[model samples]
Target: MECFFKDPCFSHEEEYRVVFFQHDIDHNEAKYNQKVLFREKSGIITPYIEVRPLTSSKKLPIQSITIGPKNNVDNAQVGLEFLLIKQGYDSISVERSRIPLRY
Candidate 1:
């Protein structure tokens, strides 16, 4: 799945970041809760996340995305990259290691 902002005014650098996940949890069994971290070029941080209860009767829609803040642009990119890595998209690499906030 691809994600991009609807507005044309956003410059290439101002685009929001997004990550897609194919969850392994069974829809009938339990909800999925994930905490994702966002880091800035200067090392400031933020988090964007989602929590969803599993459903048994039908396939849950991927359209149920939760959009996050657009203020901290760099942090948003870092958060998206972090989420992608956690979800097994291993091709990306973190150039520098920084601890993620837990709250």
Candidate 2:
């Protein structure tokens, strides 16, 4: 995906870096002291990977909610209806709110 940022002065070109996940290595292996390199778009390369333990020292719960498509009024109404039905509010109707907009 392409991303753009607005600059008030637009004085100089901006620089961006991309990072990707590499393979995991074992610490007790023969080549445990090896280093990995990452290449940039400008041909400049640098070491990126560092071998470490495969354990999380902290415990935390992650929560997430999935939402449906929201392209137009009808699509948004359908998504809202699904959410309402899941929440035990199936009596709600989107057709009741289909009145014409003033502007």
User: Which RMSD values do the candidates have, in order?
Assistant: 13.4, 15.4
Show model 2 residue runs off by greater than 4 Å.
1-71, 96-103
Candidate 2: Cα lDDT at 95: 46
For residue 11, what is the lDDT in candidate 1? Answer: 42
The TM-scores, one per candidate, come to 0.24, 0.25
Q: How does residue 24 of candidate 1 score in lDDT? A: 51
Instruction: Give the alpha carbon lDDT tens digit for every residue of 3-101 in model 2.
Output: 344343322323234454344454443353355646574487665774453448332221222232233667767777787667655664344222333
Clashing pairs in 2: none
State the displacement of the C-alpha of residue 29, model 2, in Å, after optimal TM-score superposition: 59
Q: List runs of model 1 lying over 4 Å from the truth.
A: 1-69, 91-103
Stretch of 10 with least lDDT, candidate 2: 59-68
Kindly list the per-residue Cα lDDT of model 1 for residues 1-103, writing each as its tens digit: 2354443433422334556453555653233333454556557675556545367633332322233434554786678677766765546433322323333
Clash counts per candidate, in order, are 0, 0
